[model samples]
Target: PQQPFASSTPQSSNPFGTSSQSTTFSNNSTLNSSNFSNTINCNPTNTMNYNPTNMNPSSNFTTNTFNTFTVNYEDPFLLKDITFEKVEKKTAPFSRIVPKPIFSEATMKPLLNLTYRPPRVTQKKKIYTEPSIEEARHLKEIENLVIGFEGKGRIQYIDKISGTELTTSNIEDKITFLKNEVVVSDPPGIGLNKRARVYVEGIFAFSKSQGDFIVGKAEKYPLKAIQERFVYSLKEDPYKKFVDYNYETGLYVYEVNHF
Candidate 1:
């Protein structure tokens, strides 16, 4: 065996040819080991690691560090510099309010009344009639008009005030009414939909001039002036309810509005 270099220092018994077990072996003999010790001893007690080049192929040497790898790498992101700005504090002035009391109907003079006339209103009351037996049979022939059906239709609709029926050719010109009954809109008492009634430039709105004329007036007339008295029961009609019929006189006394 050759001598080790001057700088080489052995850390333990030579790993090349040494045994950690208590069993002793002849210096010149090879170990026939099925169960061997931890290390081997070469010639010197103080030498560097055993050189792989110096190891004998037939000696069957090994090391635990043969498959290990060591690397040194630096991260680019960790080395970058980051800067941030500082924010300033702000304060706002305080505000306070005292609420007003709620409204009272009694204290407040009515929004509108007899003296205070409301804005003018224009309304169109639509009237629709059901098909009579004779007309219903010719629905397909004369004109097919079903009440309460959506969309305009081609037919005759009555103007309630004039008692005149308008004949319309186009579908859009007809009116849609739910039933034969006319819709008498309740007078709007300034509660809602307070828009003025619009009329054409030349058309006259008779509503503005509505008033009662004093037909006749007498002071304290005697009951003896009427010798005969009569009472009659009139037909109870839902539409003509305000009118009373006199069987003796064959006359109808109606409860009419002056307007």
Candidate 2:
């Protein structure tokens, strides 16, 4: 308009590429680029194709379809309406209460017969008879005589004529009168009711008779006088005075040769 204000140099070129559009900026304005106007397709459809050649041959893949299930609920207290029945219990059948006997009746019959038989009648057998009192006294006297004869110098028989002591020859026959019961009455003047016997086995007849005389006078004379007479008679008449050797000693002395 004042001749279109002319400049001396060409107009400085714009640093940004030239656009026909203009931009405006203010205090409450917003900016938007042209790329922002292009929106991404957020809800997209799968457009990829299945390719068999690109898949691995060793892979195991499966397609499984499961059926759907549904659940229903009922009252929790339904168990209270149910009823139960009672059953009776039975025991085993009864067996024998006692055991069988150890012994049978057939086997025990013989034993019972033996036990019930009649009692036997046995005869009375006499073993021995008891000795009488007189026989007992005689046996005791003989036993004492045997004891006295066994002692030294207690009783002896001597030969009147030979003046030697006489001894038994057969010792087995020394006790001859023990088995035989010989009764000799007491000497005549002694007034005794007793009985005795003297036997000197294996002696001379004269010595045995002298033994009898001495044994008979044993009740009358003291044993010392009788022993003294055995030696004193050797100095007197061998046969006659020997029996009457010590007749005058005392009351106990007796004429045994006459008796």
Candidate 3:
């Protein structure tokens, strides 16, 4: 029987799963048919090649890329609010004041009843009044003192010192003071008539909600130093509080509305 001719290359897997071992005996080695097989004819050029990466594209070499990154920032509230110099004006002056708007009684107390001090009357009397003032002016200014009206909470349209309200015939029942005093109920604002140099003798205290206050001496500010300190504190205080910087008027601005 005539044997088929084959090439001298080593055997390897075909791209297809099955292999043809029927040929390619290197060095002219011949194979005898086993059992009842006949000699076969083979072509040398009919061989196949094997590639492991070809089985799965994932096994091939690859490269990965990414995008460049960037970042940005913005101004903060503290920077926009608290600062070394003046802070940005985000709201109107005294805009933070939320009017108490609490209603006053409608009965309308009597206006400045000096008769209330009957037998107890004294030629020498010590008194403390709101929108605080000195003794001589305090007594004389009682009549002109501002009063709270309807819708206004700071002062009653009556003298707080003497417990008085607008008489039925005051004509519009408005306190005659400051900016269209016809019918407005806002209490009169206060500033000193002259320069005041107070000397605080005891503990000093103040607050925005309560206004300028002193305990030991000048009920509002006992010490001239304390007054200076109070004025400077306005710049530092978070509530935006401040005393009158006007040296001529010597005013202390309380947070109260109408004042």
Tell me how many clashing residue pairs each candidate has.
Answer: 10, 0, 11
The lDDT of each candidate is: 0.31, 0.31, 0.38
* Candidate 3 lDDT tens digits, 1-259: 5454543343466455555454534333355534333334364334366454566867756555466544334653336555576678677557457665568757888888876565755342122234344333325334334322322222222222332322333313333322112223433532211111111112234545547554433334335566557556644645323333443333323222232
Query: Which number leads on TM-score?
Result: 3
Regions of candidate 3 where Cα sits further than 4 Å from its true position: 1-145, 148-227, 233-243, 257-259
Candidate 3 global lDDT: 0.38
Poorest stretch of ten by lDDT in candidate 3: 192-201
- TM-score list, all predictions: 0.14, 0.13, 0.15
Candidate 3 vs. true structure, TM-score: 0.15
- For 116-140, candidate 1 gives per-residue lDDT tens digits of 6677895534333345434444343
- The clash tally of candidate 2 reads 0
Candidate 2 TM-score, true structure as reference: 0.13
Model 2 Cα lDDT, one tens digit per residue, 1-259: 2222221223233334332322222232223232223223221221245345556777676745576544334636566567888989876555555667788766444535545667789642221112323343434222222212321111111212111111232222232222112222334323121222223222111234355434323444355465556545443533223222232331121111211
